[model samples]
Target: MYDLIIIGAGASGLISAIVASSSGEKVLLIEKMSQAGRKLRITGKGRCNLTNTLPLKEFLKHCGSEPRFLYPAFNLFFSKELINFFEQLGLKTVEERGGRIFPQSGKAQDVFLALINEIEDSSCQVLKDTQVTSLMIENNRIVGVKAQSRTKGNKEYLAKKVILAAGGESYPLTGSQGDGIRLAKAAGHNIIPTLPSLVGLKLKDYNQERIHPSIVGFGVRNVKATISLESGKKIAEEFGELTFRENGVEGPIIITLSRQIARLLSQGERLFLNIDFKTALSEQELDEKLLSELNIRGKEDLRSVLRAFLPHELIYLAIYQTALDPRKKASFVTSQERKEILAFLKHCQFEIIGDFGYEQAIVTQGGVDLKEINPKTLESKLIKGLHFAGEVMDLDADTGGFNLQIAFSTGYLAAQNAEKED
Candidate 1:
């Protein structure tokens, strides 16, 4: 009988097995995928942003769904400890803009290699392509887990402790697919309904010609985006860069605010996205700048003159929205035309029709409810010896390595506490 059986070989499960087995406990790590960490191998656009360097208070602000529940986990092991853990495994890291950390080698495979190598060196046994279907419980305490494998058929592993790190519902191809939540539900845990978070949001009245595939990847930098109700009530706001997708908008800001947007949209609320391009400059300042550009380049075509203010692609959108003739000389442009152009540039609005589904989402917003689990120990309060970790819990965070840190810290804490005698 193993001392601990860890479900899923993703970020949290791997760390759980490593930490548990390193302390001379017999550990079994299971993965439904052909190889472990398939999702991890592709995170950060294939570069793998490991964790953030923000201080604890600032970092927790980025997390959602009971951020205080993670106090114990982060206190145990945070970004600094996580970095040191990887470096000790011979994986050097570097911090980039916005305090995001990545492997110095710029290879996510290297990060996976570091974890898998540590597992191979430890006493833990790993099983790939094995799906744990249920927790084997007796009198509401975890006794073991029942799993099925294509080659090995149905199997049962006996262990007093089981760490469920089966991940969230996002990226089904990576083998998450809400399996962990299913197991938790079957074990009598109340699950918060799951929603796609950090995904692209679709826009109403989408113009194929304007946001065509040609400009789908076009990004706007240093802008402020606001989401508001049809009643003009502000919902959420973000500042950074956002990229135009074929359906609507995406990127750093969009993904960070996607959870709130997705939740509101799911409730059948009318939402709109407002982009303020000239946030750094007031309306009067922007108008003065536009006047100077038009007067100085009076001989230039209005289209050519607009190039000084916006990207060539955005100029087309500006012209389409303002109904201004591109061929007109800048000097001949009327005051009304200039005002329309300025308005479109300052407050470009789009109705948010819906958001992308789980397939395109970076994380799942809900999972096992936090109240049912012990915040300090990460064990299920309803079931002794059953611990929870990673995205399987109702914990999720914004972009910039916060989510991955949650996985590592919670996994380590769950395993470290699970190995103790009852």
Candidate 2:
């Protein structure tokens, strides 16, 4: 029997195998896919954002909920350890904007290859096309896993200790099909409500023909996006790029707000988002600036004048929403019309009706709740020798390498702790 059996060879499983094998323990990494790291090859548009170079406290802040649960993992294998781990595997990393770390070669495949090479060098057995069907339990302890080979058809194998790094239900194409959650539930583990995270929101507006041609591929950067409830209470706010798509917004800012929006929508709450287009400018400052521009370029067409302050498509749409004519000159514009334009710019609001589903989500928000797992070992409090890591555990962070760091940290910790028991 092997010392450790890691289910799923995604980021966490791969790292766990590497760490456990390094401890001189025989490790078997099982992957249902033909190759390891199917999802890793597509991360960060194939560049593979490995980790964020931010300070520890700042990095923890990006983790929305249960950031404290990561204290032990982060202390053991933080961003610095992750960078060192890859460097030792001969995969050099470079930091980009916002301290996002990527391979110097700028290929996600290279990152995956390095991890595979490390596993190989550690004498770890890679069992590809091996789908784990269920956990093998004995006396309330996870003794092994029952897995079947996809090619061999129904042939099963058992292992000594199982680590469930099977990831959450995000990209089903990548083999994250909620099998781990199913296995965990059967083993009497509590799973949190799974929901889509880091996904794009779908708007309620039906004027797609009008909005699509105008704002597709358009992105607003360094702006504040505020989500408001039906009672006009601010739910969430973020500052980053909000990319406009034919479907809806799908950028850093939009993705960060998506989880909260999805939860609200699921609860039958009518949600609205307001973008502070010019967040850097105060209301009085913007008014003064607009009045100054008007004084210098007096009596020009209202549309032409406003075009300098907003996107042409947004200007036209705002004008339409305000019931103002774009052809009207500044001299013909009423004071109320100017006020409407300013208000719309500062608080351009839209109703969020739904999300784009799991395919577009970067990560799943909820999974096996962290409360049921020992934070230090990533082992379930309810089961002995059954460890959880990565997206499968109810831990997610905003974009910018925080999530990847968590994956590596928890995987490393789980492997180390599992090896200690061995």
Candidate 3:
């Protein structure tokens, strides 16, 4: 019998298998796909953001909820440890903006291949094209897993311990098809309501060509975006790039707000996002600047003059929405019109009808509740020898490589504790 069996060969599974095997445990890693790290290969547009170089406390802050829940994992295997681990595997890393660490080679495949090579060198057995059908439990403890191999139709393997690192239900094409959630539910673990996090927002307006030309691919930098809930309470506030999509808003800023927006939407609340395009400029500063520009170019059209401060598409959109003639001179613009212009620039609003769904989400917001798992060991409180790691757990963070760090940290903690217990 193997010492440890890891289900799913994604980032977390790969790390856990490597750690467990290096500790002298006979580890068996199973994957449903023909190859491993399908999702990892596509992350960061193939660059594979491994982890962030931020401090442990700062990294935990990116996690929206249950910051304390990650204390044990972060303390055990932080980002520095991860960098060291990759370096030991011959994969050099580089830090980019926001402390995001990517491979020096700039290839996600290199990262995956490096991890796979380490797993192989450690004498770990990797079984591909194998789909786990069910968990084999005895006396409230997991005994082994029953899976069907593509080569040998209905066969099963038994092990002493099992780690469920199967990813959350996002990017199904990458093999994250909610199978782990199904397994957790079968094993009597509480599965939290899952929603798409770090996904784009879908708007009501279908004026595709107009929206695409004006907003799509255009990123508003250093902007503060606030999601105004139906109750008039603002839920989330973020400052970053706001990428306008053909349907709605996207990019790091919008994706960060998408989780809260999606949760509010589930409660029958409609969303309205306000974008402060000039977040660095106060109202007084913006007003004064506008007055100066208007005074200097009194004969110039207000719409044409505002293009210096905003994108041409945005200026045109503002003019169209305010029903102002683009050809009107700045001198003819009334104070009320200027106020409207300021409001549009400061509070660029968009009605968020819904999220873009899991297909585009970077992570699943909710998963197996954390309370049911021992944070130190990452093992289920209700089950023995059955552990969880990575996105399958409730822990998730905002963008900038924090989520991947969570996966690596928790996976290491789980494998380490499991090996110790063995």
For all candidates in order, the CA lDDT equals 0.91, 0.85, 0.86
Best-matching candidate per lDDT:
1
lDDT of 1 by residue, 196-288 (tens): 999988988667475444567889999999999999999999998998878888898998778777778888898989888889889999999
Q: Taking the tens digit of each residue's C-alpha lDDT, what string does model 3 give over 315-346? A: 75576556677788998888898888888778
Q: Report the number of clashing residue pairs per model.
A: 0, 0, 0
Q: Candidate 3: which pairs clash?
A: none
Lowest-lDDT window of 10 residues in candidate 2?
203-212
Of candidates 3 and 1, the better by lDDT: 1
- In the range 1-422, model 2's lDDT, one tens digit per residue, is 88889999999999999989988888889898887899999999999999998998888888958999999999999998899889988999999999999999999999999998888888899889889998889888877787788567765455667899999889899999889888889898888878888888887772546643777777878889999998999999998888877866778888888976666677779999888888889988888777776666677888888887987867756765576877877777667877887888788778888788888889988889888999988999888889998999888888898888888898999999988887
TM-score per candidate? 0.95, 0.93, 0.93
